[model samples]
Target: MKKKRIYISEAHKGGRELFYIQEVFKDNWIATEGPNIVGFESDLENYLQEEVHVGALNSGTAALHLGLILLGVKSGDEVICQTMTFSASANPIVYLGATPIFIDSEVETLNMCPVALEKAIVHRILLGKKPKAIIAVHLYGMPFRVDEIRAISCKYEIPILEDSAEALGSSYKGKKCGTLGEIGILSFNGNKIITTSGGGVIVTKTLEQKSKAIFLATQARDEAPHYQHSQIGYNYRMSNICAGIGRGQMEVLDNHVILRREMHDFYVNLFENIDGVLVFNEPSADFFSNFWLTAILVDETKNGGITREILRAALEAENIESRPLWKPMHLQPVFEGYPYYGAKVAETLFENGLCLPSGSNLSDEDRERISKTIQVVFKKEIKNS
Candidate 1:
């Protein structure tokens, strides 16, 4: 008999999702504005606990676009972004007709390298286009080098657009990831720690910025009985129904984080004796990751020619799902020809990294299957030796 397929990351619904969703139906508050939306935002604010205001949007990409606007990234401007992130991190720069200068990742955090970032800022300044903002991401729930990156941001006087889309539960040095930057964003997409179905939020330092983001997100309507517009806008507000799901998910967010971290531990223990496989982990005591997805780097030389792809195939044969790490934006065809700083660090990570199954709802049977599949692959290496 064929085994069930295991996904890399999947949404796990808590018991209360239906309760909040039903409240929306009962009240006929089916539109974008409703009690659930307000309650959901409040829950996030309290959980984040930094006095930051949040404006819910249709997607994390929308949040990024609004974040750039709030940071004053206008046409013909230049913005610096981490290359080792999802395209959403860079797409907003293009949305505003600004250019993105890609920076490479460091080996330690697999995030923006401060050295490369400083170099990019200086070089861009020399070219007569000072960057308006910096986009730094907490990749796969691992907080970036927050102190180093923030210092660079201060020295260059460029505000950071923190992409905490994958880091809702991650923290650095006692502060939440989203609260570290001048402006931040969180994703509640279906695959994230908490799902708003398909929603995100832009975290601002003040209520005024949050109000402005909501105004822009809701088509920038002027205050009048008749429809009037002072500037351009977008239809980006999250629906009340989706926020209902978020409200329920928020009820169990911490538990989900715990489960995901336990999965990371599972992989760490699984690979402890397996040669050539290094699980991606927090570098030091200062960082706390959600372990949204547990990833590993495969060293083919030490594994007797077993590469990431080969191991991925081994899992696939057993009806499991796995994926490669993000190919750095600098290497993507659409993003090629853009100004890129730093060396082949991002490239090397892309070549060797693989994301494993890390859903919070995985059962003991599922883990046994995954463990058995991986063990079979390494056992071959031992036999070859």
Candidate 2:
């Protein structure tokens, strides 16, 4: 029999999604508005344990677009973004006809570098275009240098749009990640720590901000008996059906975080003795990562020329899925010629890093397969050494 393919990350149901989904169907609340939507938002607010509001949306991208709008990012405005993140983080700046000023990452967390961030701010202001907002991300569930970045934001008087899409269960210094910035967003895509089939939320510090987000999301309708629109709006609200799934997923979210951290430990142990392979992990006790996807940095010189690509190919040969780190946006064609700060940290990380299989539903057999495949790849170096 052929071995089943292993994915980098996949949705793991908590067994209660169907129950909530059934409740939605029973009540005929199939559209974007319903009790499930409200319940999911409340569940998220409670989970964060912070005084904040959440507005559920169809996608994290929509949350980002609305977030930029709320931040007052307008045409010709420049937004400072960490280049080493998903394009969704920067695309919103473009959506509102703004330019993106890309910043590099620090080696420790592979997140936005404060030194570079400040440098970008100072230099952009020198060019008569002070950035409107700072878009920082908690890459791969590891919290960014929040305090450091926050200080820069305060010093420069720029707001931070925290992208915690991959960090639902992660925290920094006991404070939740999504609540760290002035405004934040979360993703519940099929591959995230939890799944709402497809959903996200814009997290704000005030009910007024959340209300505005909801209003714009639902087509900016005015309070009238008839369809009346005074401003631009988007069809971005989360469906009741999807929120039902989210309500159930919330029940198992903490357990899933534990499982994902366990997967990170699995990789740490698997690569502990392997030269040239360094597992990505939290830098200190102040950080708690969900380990959304366990990644590694491969040093070819130490591994006798075995690159990350070679390891990725080996995993593919065994029907296991793996992928390279996100290519920094500054290097992509769509973002070329844009203002970029810092040196080659983001570029270097992209060249050397690879994300491994890290799904919460991986069985013991699956682990064995992944472990065996990885070890086999390194054993070739041992033989040649």
Candidate 3:
């Protein structure tokens, strides 16, 4: 019999998840408003230290769009975003008809480069248009250089939109990732640490921001009994059913973080002795990564010219799923015309990086099979060299 295929990430839903969903159905509260939605938001607020108000939304993209709206980003304004992140980080910029100025990543954290960001800010200022906000992401659950990024934002007097979509359980200096910026976004997509099936939240520091986000997300309904509208709005509220899933998922969130860290350790141990393999890890003690998806960089110079693609193909032959790191946004055709700043760090990372199988529920058999395939590829490459 053929072995089971191991994927890079997968949602782990149990009876508890289903039980919550059933409760929502039994109560006939399947729409966007319900006790589950309130409970989930409260749970997140407490878990994240209550420093920020949380607004449940349909997806992380919705959270980002609302965050930009809160930041006063509008048509013709420019927003500085980390180029090495998922496109969602930049797509919201275009959603508001604002341009995104892509900043490259640093090699250590594979996140926004502080120096490049400052350079971009100054360059934009000289062009007579100061960027309205900065969108820095915690890529792959690894926190960016929070201190440095915050300092730069403060110096420039620019607000930050922290995209913690893949970093809900991650932290920097003991503070949660999603609470670091003026406004933060989280994703509960099936692939994230805690799956709401599909949902997200926008986090902010004040009631006004929270209320405004809620208003804007719910079609900007004015205070009236009948249908009313005073401004533009969106249909981005999370369904109560989905919020129930989120509530249940929150119950096991800490456990999920622990399992993800264990997976990271496993990859670290497996690749420690491999000459050309470099596991992507927390840059320092200050950064606590959730290790959402364990990734590695294969240095061809040290690996006798063997490339990441070669190993990716070998793993594919064994029915193991992996993926190349996100290509820098500046390289994407849709974002090509935008301005970009920094050296080739992000470009190099894209050239050699690959995500490994890192599902929190992966079995020992899955690990052994994956490890064996990788070992075989490296062994053959060494032999050929």
Candidate 4:
């Protein structure tokens, strides 16, 4: 018989999703336009503690596309992006026929390094082309150096699309991630802190921006007695059923963040005495991460010759799932020719880091199984030494 497999991050239900779904079905609001969408957006606005506008969409990628569009990014333009995140963060720049200038991450946050950002900006401008916008990401729910990044954006006079897709409940200096930039986006993908099944939301500081996003998302129909259009658009609005799920997820968002943080705490204690495994965490009191997916950097030299890949393979043998960190975009074949700035921080992270199981619904038994499997590998390494 096969052992039970442990997933890295699984969608957790809050028990209220079904109730909300029933409400949507009962109200017969099966399309994208319905009360659920409004309720979900309102819930997010209240939770984020900002008077911001929210536009729900089909996926986080769509939200990014809309953000780039609203930032006036067009063909032949350039957009600066963090290289240490999922490709969604930079692909939108390419979607608009704009080139992405990938910047490396810093050691502290595993996010975009501000020094590299300014360097990229200055060099791009020196070459007679100012970047259309900046796409800063908070990778793995860890908030980037928000203050420094924002200062660079202001100094360069460029808009920023804050990619908070993996950082919905994360915050920096007491402010929510999505609300910190000119255009912010959240992902409710299955592997995220909260799942709307599959959806995303755009956070705008003004109603006009929110209105513009909705117009573009719903096929850019002009207000008329009959369907009219003057601009190209996309079908990216979230369905009512999915919004109902989102609303339910919102009710438990804080609790989910807490649970994910607890998972981080679990890794902290588990690796405390271990020589080579260091859990990724907040650098100071100012940054509060949702701890969406607890990651670790394994120092093979210090830890009995066990590398991240060795640890990952051992876990897989135990029917436990773990994954490597995102490969930096600049190193990807698709983005090779684009300009990149800064040191090898992102490369180091990718080479040594591994993501553990961090689902909110992970039980004590699951933790025990994970801990035991990890201990076995480390013990073998120690014995060999």
Candidate 5:
């Protein structure tokens, strides 16, 4: 018989998702606007606890796009972005006809390097172009160096659009990840910590910003009696049905965070005696990561030629899923030729990193199988070395 497959990350629905969906059905509120949409936003506001307003959208990419628009990013402008993250963080810059200047990662958090960031800022200014915005990511749910990055942002008078798509429950210095910058974004994709099936939100400091985001997201309809258009708009608003799922997921979000952290601890123990296998973790007590996907760095030179690719292939052979870390956006074919800062930190991470299975819904049996696959692979490699 084939071994059961393990997922890298998959949606774990709370029991109450159906209840809210049923409520939507009873109220005949299955469209884009409904009580569930409002309730879900309120739940997020209360949980974020930063006195910020959130605008729900159809996808995280939409949130980032709207954030750039709200930040006054326009054609012929340049935006600074962390190259070590998923492309969604940088794609919106091009959507607005702006250029994305990529920066490298720091080893500690695999996030935007503060030193490199400031250097990039100074260099860009030297070239007669002050970037319009900064995009920083909390990669793999690990909180970045918030104070250092924010200090650079403020010093240069640049607004930060925090990409917290992988860090809903992560925090830095007691502040939630999504509330740390001028604008923040969250994802509710099926593979994230929570699921709205497919949805996202933009976090803003004031109600005015939130209101404007909503206005732009909802086709930018002016208060005219007949249909009218002044500015270009998009149908990016979240549907009530998806918001229903979000409401139910919020009920269990804390539990999900705890479960994911437990998975991280499991990996810590599992790899305790495995030489040259270092689990990605927060560098200091000030950072709290949700561990959205537990990742490890495989140092082949120290581990007898065993590599991330070797382990990834081993996992795949057993019908289990694993993935390499996000390739640096600067290296992608679509983004090649963009100006990149820092040396090779981002490149090194991509060369050696691998994401492990970390679904909150994984069972003990699933973990046992995964562990056996990894153990067997390590044993063979160690013996040969």
Candidate 6:
């Protein structure tokens, strides 16, 4: 019999999730507006602890789109984005007819490079089009250099849209990731720390911003008894059923973070002495990563020329799933024409990085199987050498 496949990430569902979903169905409030939706938004707002208001949206992408709208981004404007992130982070820029200027990642956090960001801002200003906003991401649950990036954003007077989709439980110097930016986005997709099944939320500092987001998300209806029309809007509100799942997920979020961090430690111990394999970790004390997905960089020069692809293939042969890091947006055919600034760090990471199985539900037996498979690969390399 073939071994079970070990996925890089998986959602953990429990009784609470099922109970909430059943309650939503029992209440006959499966659509956008319902008690669970309102309650979940309140829970998130309180968790963030910055007097921020939240608008539950249909997806992280929708939240990004609305965030752009809230920031007054318009056609022909330019928005700077981190190159090494999921496309959703940059796609919203295009949704507003604005161009995205890609900034490469720094090695420490594998996130936006502050120096590159400043350079991009200056270059854009020289071209007679200052960027309308900056979208900085906390990749793989690791907080970016928040202080440095905030300084740069402040220096240039550009608003920041924090892409904390992969970093809900992450913190920097005790401050939550999503609360630091002018506007922030969170994802509750199935593979994230918390699963809403499929949902997102927008976090903003003011009630006015939250109200505007809620109005726009609900199709921008004008005030009147009958059907009315006004500004363009989107049907991006989260369903009541999904919000129930989010509420349940929130109950166990801290446990999820602990499990993820444990998984990271396991990988670290597994590969620490391996000469060419370096696990990506928190760069310093200030960074408190949730370690969403344990990733590693394979330096072929020190590993007898064994590449990331070779290791990935080995894992695949054993029915285990692994994946390469996100390809920098600047290299994507759709984004090839956009302006990019920074060194080749992001490109290098794309070529050599790999995400290992890090599911919170992984069992001891599963870990043993994964460890043995990895050991076999290294042994084969050593024998071949």
297-329: candidate 4 lDDT, tens digit per residue: 999999889999999999999899999999999
**Model 5: CA > 4 A from native:** 380-385
My TM-score estimates for the predictions, one after another, are 0.98, 0.98, 0.97, 0.98, 0.98, 0.97
Compose the digit string of candidate 1's lDDT tens values, residues 1-385. 8877899998998749999999999999999999989999899899998989989899999999999999999999999999999999999899899999999999878999999999999989998899999999999999999999999999989999999999999999989988999999999888998898899999999999999999999999999999999999999999999999999999999999999999999988888877799999999999999999998999999978899999999999999999888999999998889999999999999999999999999999999888888878888332110
C-alpha lDDT of all candidate models, in order:
0.93, 0.93, 0.92, 0.92, 0.93, 0.91
Off by over 4 Å in 1: 380-385
After TM-score superposition, the amount by which residue 295's alpha carbon in candidate 4 deviates from its true location, in angstroms, is 0.9
Candidate 5, residues 191-258, lDDT tens digits: the string is 99999999999999999999989999999999899988799999999999999999999999999999
lDDT of 6 by residue, 2-71 (tens): 9888888988975387788898889899788999999999999888877789999999999999999999
Model 4 misplacement above 4 A: 380-385
lDDT, candidate 2, 273-329, per-residue tens: 788989988999999999999989999999778899999999999999999999999
TM accuracy, model 2: 0.98
Please give, for residues 1-385, the per-residue lDDT of candidate 3 as tens digits: 7768898999976527778889998999979899989999999999998577999999999999999999999999999999998999999999999999999899899999999999999999999999999999999999999999999999999999999999989999999989999999999999999989999999999989999999999999999999989798999999999998898899899998998999999988887778898999887899999999998999989988789999899999999999999999999999988999999999999999999888889988888888888778877322110
Q: How good is model 3 by TM-score? A: 0.97
Candidate 3 residue pairs in backbone clash: none
lDDT of 4 at 298: 97
Candidate 3: regions farther than 4 A off: 380-385
